[model samples]
Target: MSEILRLDAVSRHFSGLKALSGVTLRIDKGEVLGLIGPNGAGKTTLVNAVSGVTPASSGKITFMGRDITGIKTYQAARLGLARTFQIVQPFAEFTALDNVAAAALFSQPGESLKSAREEARAHLAFVGLEAQAGQSAATLTLAMRKRLELAKALAMKPKLLFLDEVNAGLNSAEVERATQLIHQLAASGITIVMIEHLMKVVLNVCTRIAVLHNGVLIADGPPREIIKNPAVVDAYLGHQYAQRNAAHG
Candidate 1:
C-alpha cells in the first residue's frame, strides 16, 4: 500500500515533561490502524501532534509526501486531515445539521452556508443522523452525539481520519453501531487511525495495531501478533486479556 502519513522520531514536550518521545510511525493509504494503550500513554498526544492540535517539539510529520510538522489545525483540516474528539463537544444551541455545516464551512474555503448545509445533510445521512438533523445538538442522546461528531468530521472530507476513543462510553449495541460505521468508513478507502480501549472493537475493525506505553511505542503488528506480544501484554493488554484470547483461540 502507498504511504499516506509518516512520523519520523516525533517528540512533544510540555513544560519539560515528554508527552511523546521519539515516536516514529507510518500509515498506509486505506489502512485501519488501531492505536491502543493504557491511560496517559501518549496515544492522544501523538494524534494531536500529527493533526497539528499540538505541534511536535522535534522530528517531522509528512502527509501525502509533504512535511506538515508545523501546520495549524485548520490547515491540517484543509489538507484532508480530520479527527473526532474523544469528548464530543458540539455547539449545543445549533441544530445537528448546523453543527455539521459549521465544520464544512470551516474546513473548505469559500463554502457558503447554504452549500455547507446541503453537504452537511449528506454527511449526517451517511452517519445515520439524517432524522435528527433539525434537532438541537444538546437534545441528542450520547450515541447520537457521537454519530454527530462523525458526521462533522466527514463534512471535512478527510483522506486520513483520526478517531479518538469513539466507543469510550458506549453500550454494547451502540459500540456495534459505531463499529459498523467504522467498517463502512474503512471500506470506503479512508485511511484511519483509531485510539480505542476496547480490544474487541480494535481487533474487529483494525488491520494492524500499535501499542503505546508511557510515551513510547512498544509494539506494532497485525492484531494476532500484537495480542501475543510480551511488551504489549505487560504495558496494556495484561495477562487476563492474553488468557481470555487463548481460551477463545
Candidate 2:
C-alpha cells in the first residue's frame, strides 16, 4: 500500500513541557495503526498535531504528500482528515441525524442538506445508530453518543481518521461493537490512527501498534511483538504481565 501520512520529528510544546517530542511515524494507506501509551504519553497531542487540532512546535507532517503541519482543523477536515474526541460532544439540541448531516454538509463540497441527511442516515446505520437517528443528541446514552461520534466522522468521508479513545467508557459489548466498526472501516480502505487505553480493543483491531511515553515514541511494531517487548511492558503494560511470562518460561 502507498504511504498516506508521515510525521517527521514532530514535536509539540507548552511552556517548558514537551507534549510530543520528535515523534516520527508513518501510516501506510489502509492500515489501522494503534497509538498506545500511558495517560500523559502525548498520544492525544500527537494526534492533535497531525489532525490540525493543535499546531506542532517543530518538524514536518506530510499528509497525502502535502505539508499540513499546522493547518487548522477546518482546513484539515476539508482535506479528508477527521477525528473523534475522547469526549463525544455532539450538538446537544440537534437530533442525532441532524448532527451527522451537519458534518456531512459542512465538510463535503456541494452536499445539500437533503442529500446530507440521506447520507447521514446511512453512516448512522453503519455505526448501528440508525434507529436512534431522530433522538436529540443529549438524549442518547453514552454508547449511542459514541456511535454518533463515529457516524459524524464518517459523514465527513475522511480518508484518514484519528479515533482518540473511542472506547473510553464503553462496556465490553460496546467496545466489541466499536471494534467491529473499526475493523469494517479499516477493511473498507480507511487509514486510521487509534489512541486507545483498552489493550483488548487495540489487539483485536490494530494492524500495528505504536507506543509512546513521556511525550516520546518508545516503540513501534506489530501487536504481538510489542506485547513481548520488555520496554513496552515496562513503560505501559506494566511488569506484571512480563513477570508472569518470564515465570512461565
Candidate 3:
C-alpha cells in the first residue's frame, strides 16, 4: 500500500507546554491504526495537528505526497481527510438527514443539491440511521447522534478518517455495534487513525496500535506486540501484574 499520511517529527506546543513531542508516524492506504493512550497523552492533539484543527509547532505533515501542514481545517477536508469529534456536534436546528446533507454540500464537487442529498441519504443508511433521517438532530439519543456523526463524515468521502475517542461514552452493546461499523468502513478500503480509550474497541478494530504517553509515542506495532511492551503496558496497557512480577524477579 502507498503512504497516505505522514507526520514527520511532528510537535505541537501550547504556550510552552508540549502537547505532542516529535511524534513521527506513517499511515498506509487501507490500514486501521489505533492511537491508544491514557488521558493527557496528546493523542487528540496529534489528530488535531494532522487535521488542521490546530497547526503544528514544528516538523512536517504530508498527505498523499502533498505538504499539508498548517492548512485550514476545511482544506484538510477538501484534501480527502475527515474526522469525528469526541463530543458529538450536530446542527440542532436541522434534521439528522439535513445534518448529513450539510456535509454533502461542503463535499460537493460542483454537484447539485439533489445529488448531494442523494449521497447523504446513502451514507445515512450505511450508518444505519435511515429510519431517523427526518428526526431533528437535537432529539436523537447518544448512539443515534454518534451514528449521524459517522454518516456526516462518510458523506464527505474521505480517504483518511480520524476518529477521536469515539467510544468514550458508549455502552457495551453500542460499542460493539460501533466496532462493527468501523470494520465495515475498513473493509471498504478507507484508512483510519483513531484515538481510542476503550481497549476492547482499539484491539478489535485496529490491525496496528500506536501508544502515546505524556504526549510522546512510546510504542507502535501490531496489537499482540504492543500489548507486550513493558513501557506500553506500564503506561496504558494495564500490565501492573507483569510490572510487579518483573520487580520481584
Candidate 4:
C-alpha cells in the first residue's frame, strides 16, 4: 500500500508535561489502524497534533506527502484530514442538516450553503440520519448524535479520518452499528485511524493496532500479535484480556 501519512519524531509539550514523546509512525492508504492505550496515554493528544488541533512542539507531520505540522484545524480539514471529537459537541440550536452543512461549507472553499445542504443530506443519509436531518441536534439521542458527528466529518470529504472513541458510552447494539459504519468506511478505501477502548470493536474493525503508553508507542502490529505482546499486555491489555483472547482464538 502507498503511504498516506507519516509522523517523524513528533513531540508535544504542555508546560512541563510531555503529551507526546518522539512518536514516529506511518499510515498506509486504505488502512484501518486502531490506536489503543490506557487513559492518559496521549492517544487523543496524538490525534490532535496530527489534525492541527494542537501543534506539535517539535518534529514533522506529513499528510499526502505535504507538510502539515503547524497547519490550523480548518486548514487540515481543507486538506482532507478530518476527525470526530471524543466528546460530541454539536451546535445545539442548529438542525442536524444545518450542522453537517456547516462542516461542508467551511471545509471546502467556494462551497455555497445551498450546495452544502444538498451534500449534507447525502452524508446524513450515509450515516443513517436522514430522517433526523430537520430535528434540532440537541434533541437527538447519544447514538444519533454520534452518527451525526460522523456525518459532519464525512461532509468534510476526508481522505484520512480520525475517529476518537466513537463507540464510547454506547451499548452493544449501538457499538455494532458503529462498527458496521466503520467497516463500510474502510471498504470505501478511506484511511482511518481510530482511538478506541473496546478491544472487541478494535479487533473487529481494525487491520492493525498500535499501543501507546506514557506518551510513547510500545507496540505496533496485527491485532493477534498485539494482544500477545508483553509490553501491550502490561501497559494496557491485562492478563485477563490475554487469557480470554487466547481462549476465544
Given candidate 1, what's the lDDT at residue 228?
96
Clash count for each candidate, listed in order shown: 0, 0, 0, 0
Clashing pairs in 4: none
lDDT of 1 at 62: 99
Q: What are the per-residue Cα lDDT tens digits for candidate 2 across 1-249?
A: 899999999999999999999999988999999999899999999989988788999999999999998899888888999999998889999999999999997787687889999999999889988799899999999999999999999999899999999998989899889999999999899999999988778888999999999999999999989988988998989888777656866
For candidate 3, write residues 1-249 as lDDT tens digits. Answer: 899999999999999899999999989999999998889999889989988889999999999999999999888888889999999989998999889988877866676878888888899899889998899999999988999999999988899999887777889999988899999999999999988877667878899999889889899999878877889878876777456645765
Name the candidate, 2 or 3, with the larger lDDT value: 2
Which residue segments of model 3 deviate by more than 4 Å? 240-249
Model 2 alpha-carbon miss at residue 204, Å: 1.0
- The TM-score of predicted model 4 comes to 0.99
Better of 2 and 4 by TM-score: 4
How do the predictions measure up, each by TM-score?
Answer: 0.99, 0.96, 0.95, 0.99
CA lDDT, candidate 2, residue 148: 95
lDDT of each: 0.95, 0.91, 0.89, 0.95
What is candidate 4's lDDT per residue for 83-196, written digit by digit as tens?
Answer: 999999999999999999999988997999999999999999999999999999999999999999999999999999999999999999999999999999999988999999
In candidate 2, the residue pairs with backbone N, CA or C atoms under 3 Å apart (3 or more residues apart, or in different chains) clash, namely none
